[model samples]
Target: MSLNANDRSIAAFTMAGHALVHWFETSIPIFLVVWLAEFDVGVALFGVVVALGYAPFGLGALPGGILADRYGTRPLVLACLGGMSLAFLVLAAASSIYAIAAGLILWGIAASVYHPAGLALISTGVEDRGTVFAWHGIAGNAGIALGPFVAATLLIFLEWSVVAAVLAVPGVLAVLYGLGAEFDPTAAVADDADAGPDEALSPAALFSDSRTLFASAFAVVFVLVTFEGLYYRGTLTYLPEILHGLPAIESLALPAGLEGIQPADYIYVGLLVVGMAGQYAGGKLTNRIAPARGLAAIFAVLAVLALAFVPVTASGVGLAPIVALCGLLGFFLFAIQPFYQNAVAVFTPPDARGLSYGYTYLAEFGFGSASIALGGFVLGEFSQTVFFAMIAAFAGIGGLFAGALLVGGDRFAGTAETLEANADD
Candidate 1:
């Protein structure tokens, strides 16, 4: 096959593998309490376990980017997937807490391998940057949207071990296909950079060293992405636990039909679906309104929803309204992604694009690791409601910062007004 066809197929496999891990890991959050009971693990340890899964992802992303640039996306992608499938297969037989944590950590390492390279591949491979990137974004979010549902549905009939084992199959398939493809863009980059103009392609650009503007923009986005991961992780991880707490959703939570309706499960599913819708909405509004205005609006919504989380915990209100609110919350929550992506895309340079992508995720998964720890601590010590409420504050602050970046200065502001003017033409 031609490079284009090969790239697309590889992209599909890469994305699918990435999404499967995303979906598979949701099981941890879904079966949080169950795992506790089955293994007798403590909350702190639980948090550590969860955090460890993502800890490597934050640390490994940049290097992975460099490696993908040095090696080939085709080989790296397949090896990573194969490694992850091996990790999941380990999950099926894990008899102790340490074993499970080990599996998750390895799996996380494996999962992190795909993004930087996969993105670089797609960005360089496809001729139209916009169409390819938009599709890539949609694929990622769609994975986030679908994985939890697939996980939760399987939970209805399978043991956690079975579920863990089953999730490995897709990765195996991804590896098989990935190994057969040939993509050598990084080699091309190496060759061209050597022969072309003496542009400064420093290692610092890819590693921890970032320019001032890039650093500032990265910090702003760190907050945004941290909250995004926190929200996504919390929703996927806690919904099942929340469902067990509320008898209302047991009937409705499953695909086969919830044995009962756990209003919380409905809320979880609602948030995901709404999040998917919100991404679409955000995409539509990004060019029409300044990202700052949209971000401000999103933050405002996140803050309200975060606070709302406490009341909706079935400790105070019924599940139905919370379920509705979950959908509403998701609508605004997931919509912020494009705005975030666009903001970063606008600020980053071509040479250091890998570093930019890596650090963006470093902020994402680093805080993600921390957030899981925090969520586990809170859920173990306090109410899930309170845990969620605190995240609201985090999400709110992140959104506010993003908004400020968009419009507070001469840099990102007045687009809303300008767009309005453009509409008149």
Candidate 2:
């Protein structure tokens, strides 16, 4: 079915907002190392800064979701963009490590506000939530995947402050475009939502009760996503810092301070690019393999890739080819995101979609923050090999959690079916 111009515009608007959020958010890890180096701090403190920037997604998820349900998703999303733009401004002006950490915390809190509201809005805004989410996943992941390059490139030329200032452009534009327009979000929820169909419970009410099949489904996915979140955080958050001390990399005869440019970044980006490609392909398969199996497989691949990272970090092979292999690993790791997103959408409802997604993201970031903090501390205390090995172990643990979802996913599916039947009754 062809979407009318308005829905198309709305979808575009949502994507723009999502992209802007990702643009700034992706820079957090890279900035952690760059700023740390510039500030003359121990690399172990990478956790303190990164967590300050990332942990609030957990803290704000529920409230953000509730705001979307009670008020409206549109205004909330625009507000988030405005907040994000303002955050970049603060980050640009920050001086001391304390100041930057504060800025990151504020930015994290504000950015966290977007996911529940924005994701809920997207679930309603577009016609096919699965495809819409796949695109959303691609857009966000691609930004994350590409952000390091952006940071690295900027680091090569401009000051870090200027780099942040430059990245602020998209967020400001998103807010402006959103403010200039208006639409019936209720209409977007479902074609028949305006007719007072099945969507009775408010986002808050649904959140308060939390018994829907969708909510239960979210619980199972929540555990797995948490595992993925930890693994996710360990993967890129520690990348540049992890590679900082490798003996082989030191021998590359590269100039001082630019040694973080391992073949790994290319591999990581390649993996993400592949994953983005996978999201596109996986969306097509959501009806066949199921989001459960797809997510499980995705987690398994990420675990393997984590192990692969150990060697890539340790082995001092020539830069180009090893990096290419790294990218291939990333491709497989990233491919499963669409399935995870679709699973969230299918299991959720129009009203509380915000809360479902909000909580899911919260699970991801909260654990991710803690994991990075602990991982950073571990790196400070032990060998880089041990550090990478621990992250790999966590990946294995996360995979086990994700795999259990494969075992239990059907139960939630059955429960959701029963709830729908009861809701119908």
Candidate 3:
């Protein structure tokens, strides 16, 4: 189906918003390498520092959602972009670990508002929900891949702080662009009788609505998203660093003056690049298969990938086999996202879309942020094999939850009409 002008506008805004969010998100791991080398800190301690920022990123989602509900997506989105840019400026000027922590926390708080606002906008504003989401996921994956790629590429020629400063410029431009963008924010929900008044929910009403959501299939989705978050944060948070240590990656040669270019970084970028295909396929697949079923299979694949990651990297076979493994890992790692994202929309009412997404991310990022600490501790105290084992456990647990959703079938909550409404023609 062709997108109308409003749908295109919303998709464009969201695609930009989604890309910027991941751009900052994936770039952090690249910075982590510099911080580790420069700062006199252990991995475990530094993980806590990172967690301090990420915790609020997730924890604030609930309130961010409430704000999105009270105000509108555009205002909150503008706030998110402006705040994230300013936070990066602070990071660029930081002189101490404490300063970096403060900057990360600021960025986390600022960036926290994006997913809820952007996804809710798509859910309510875009007529071609699934197709837009596919594009949205593709944009996010582009950011995910490009953020680290750009950061690594720039670090070769510039200081990390200067690179950070340069990265902030795009958000400033995006904010300028957003101010002039036009669209009806709630056009999809305009005709729905159940969209409720465009006003703030009372505390009591909020509680009731939240209770209703938790009472439904959204509850299962919450669990599934949380595990997905754990696997995501656990793996991606340290993946580039992990790849850097491999003999397979270390053996690759670069030009003499370009010794600063770590092949591992590009390999990591390639992995995320493949994830763009995964995201597109996952989004479109939701139109054909039950999202829960797709999630079940994807999570199962993730579990196997996590278990295989260390062995494959450690094997002396060659870089080809290792690269292939990372490629597969990247594809499945991201492919699961659209499935769960679509699931959230199907399970919740349109009126509470923002809050629903807020809670969804709270589970995904908030509770999931703890894995940073957990992963750091595991990597520090145990071997990389053990660390991957822990990741496998997270994916395995997520698969089990996905299975529960599949087995429960229509007995799970969510109105049938929502499924029909969201189904692609």
Candidate 4:
């Protein structure tokens, strides 16, 4: 279906917003090594600080969703961009470790609003949501990849503080664009209008009537998302450090004037860049495949790849093979996102989509934050082998949940179809 000019405009703006938010969020990890050296903190302690910064990204999502539903997505998105810009400004001026921690916490809080608000706008406002979501995912992956690449490149020449300030420019531009943009929050579904006025906005109503949401299909998806969060945050949080330890990457030849750049930084960015294709593929898969089955397949690959990472790197294999494995890992890891995101929409009522995504990210980011500390401890106390094993276990559990969904999702399929039919009418 062809989108009208307004729909295209909204999609473009929302996609840009996605990139801006993720750019800020993902840049933090790239800055971690710099912070570690400057602060002289141990890995475990730094992990805790980073966890504090990341925790709010999950913790604040539910409220962000509620606010989006109550106030409007455009304003919340604008607030997210503005608040993130302010947070980066704070980071640029930070002097002490506490100051840095505070800036990161503020950044986390500001970043938390984007996923629900942005996704809600696309889910409700766009006509061909799956394709739009694909483009959105690609934009997010661009941020994910570029955040580190840009930060790493800047760090080679500029101070980290200056880099922080520079990173806020996109948010500023996005805020300006957001202020003048027009979007319809009620364009996709009329579930809210169909409900009793009292029930439409009542949190009590949301909970009391959430049994359908917590039934077999949604419950399985939640479990799957929780595990995905654990694996995602656990692995990606320290990936640069992990790659840095590899001798193969360390010995690679470098170009002129780029001697200061770490191989790990390049590899980390490369992995995320490769993930952009995975995001697009997963998005396309949503139209051609069942969400549950697609989730099961990709997650199963994630489990195997997680287990293989340490072994492959440890085998003293050359840089070429190791880099290929990293690329594959990136592809499977990010490929799971679009599937589960689509699954959430399929299993929930339209009026409650914001809440659905709120809880979805809460699992993916909130519980996922625990992995930072857990992974830090394992890395500090035990070994990388143990850490990768734990990540693999998380993927394994997530695959089980996806498999269960594949077996049982048929019971809930009608919920999405009925909602879609209602919207079409």
Per-residue CA lDDT of model 1 for 308-397, tens digit only, reads 766666464555775677677777767776666555544543344455566666666656656666778888998876887877877777
Sorted on lDDT, highest at the top, how do the candidates line up? 3, 4, 2, 1
Worst 10 residues of 4 by lDDT: 191-200
- Superposition error at 138 for model 4 (Å): 1.1
Candidate 2 wrong stretches, greater than 4 Å: 1-7, 28-51, 93-102, 145-163, 181-207, 211-215, 242-275, 310-321, 377-425
Question: Per-prediction count of colliding residue pairs?
Answer: 13, 5, 0, 0
Misplaced by over 4 Å in model 1 are 1-14, 29-51, 72-75, 93-99, 122-163, 179-209, 212-216, 227-263, 283-293, 308-320, 372-389, 408-425
The whole-model lDDT of each prediction reads 0.62, 0.68, 0.85, 0.81
Q: Give the alpha carbon lDDT tens digit for every residue of 247-346 in model 3.
A: 8778888788989777886788798889988888887788888888999999989989888877776676678877898899888888898899888877
Spell out the clash pairs found in candidate 2. Answer: 267-326, 267-327, 271-330, 271-331, 275-335
Q: After TM-score superposition, what is the CA distance of residue 20 in candidate 4 from its true location, in Å?
A: 1.3
Worst 10 residues of 1 by lDDT: 191-200
Candidate 4 per-residue C-alpha lDDT over 1-425 given as tens digits, one digit per residue, 9 for 90 to 100: 56776567777888888898889988898788999999977888888888788889899998787666666678888999998999999989988788888999998898898887888777776666777777788899898878877988899999999999999998998899888887665566645563111223565555543454675377788889999999998988888788898888878889999898788877887888888888888877887888889988888898888888878756788888778888998888888888998888777766556767777888898888789889999999998888889999998898888988888888876554454343334
